[model samples]
Target: MFLGTGGMTPGHQLAERDDRKTAWAWYRGRAVRDLANGYTMKRVYR
Candidate 1:
């Protein structure tokens, strides 16, 4: 799933795979090491 901030701005992306598992944040058009302070994310189990 993809979450956009602005009308046409890039935002966070989440994907699930059996072989790969990790959370990532993106800014502008590049992958970031970490998000800014006060930002947080929670994982939901299905």
Candidate 2:
């Protein structure tokens, strides 16, 4: 049902140019099982 529990956003600012590109690509992946409704879902981004 896509409970939209929790998720991560990968972003950066131009001021933070010192940051590495890999850092922006790293984000938390999430998924859950909902057998009662017979569906699998993942968190949604705002």
Clashes of 2: 0
Q: Model 2, range 1-46, lDDT digits (tens) per residue? A: 2333344212234334435444554421122223423442322321
Cα lDDT listed for each candidate: 0.34, 0.35
Which residues of candidate 2, in runs, are more than 4 Å off? 1-19, 28-46
Instruction: Give per-model TM-scores.
Output: 0.12, 0.18
Mind giving the per-residue lDDT tens digits that candidate 1 earns over 1-46?
4345554333232234421343222242243324422144423321
- Alpha-carbon runs more than 4 Å astray in model 1: 1-11, 14-20, 23-46
Query: Scored by Cα lDDT, where does model 1 land?
Result: 0.34
Model 1: pairs clashing at backbone N, Cα or C within 3 Å: none
